[model samples]
Target: MQFLAALLLQADGTDLTRPDLTINYIIIGVLLVVAAVLSVIVVRRRMQERDDDWE
Candidate 1:
C-alpha cells in the first residue's frame, strides 16, 4: 500500500504532505466518514428486516 501511494504521488508530481492539500485531505476524510455511516445504517436495516429464525 505504501508503494502504491508513493507511485501515485510521483505520477501526480505533487506531495500530499503539503499544507495546500489540507482541504483536499479534510474533504476526503469527511466523505469517508459519511460513507461508513450510510453503510452501517443500510446493513442494520437489512438485518432487522430479515426473519429471526435464521439467527
Candidate 2:
C-alpha cells in the first residue's frame, strides 16, 4: 500500500504521478488557433467567389 502511494506521488518512467499539463494546453491552444485561421480562410475564399459570381 505504501509503495502504491509512493508511486502515485512520484513521477515514474510512465508518468505515474500528476503530469505537467502546460505543454498539452499550449498545444491545444495552438491547434485551435490554426483551425480558426483555416476556417476563416475557407469562408473568405467562398465569399470572394460568391461576390465575383454576383457581380
Assess every candidate by TM-score: 0.58, 0.67
Evaluate all candidate structures by whole-model CA lDDT and list the values in order: 0.86, 0.90
Q: Tell me the tens digit of each residue's lDDT in model 2 across 1-55.
A: 9999887767455654567999999999999999999999999999999999999
Q: Which stretches of candidate 2 lie over 4 Å from their true place?
A: 1-16
Alpha-carbon deviation at 39 in model 1, angstroms: 0.3
Model 1 steric clash total? 0
Cα lDDT tens digits for candidate 1, 1-55: 9999889878895654545878998999999999999999999888887856477
Once fitted onto the true fold, the runs of candidate 1 whose alpha carbons sit more than 4 angstroms away are 1-19, 52-55
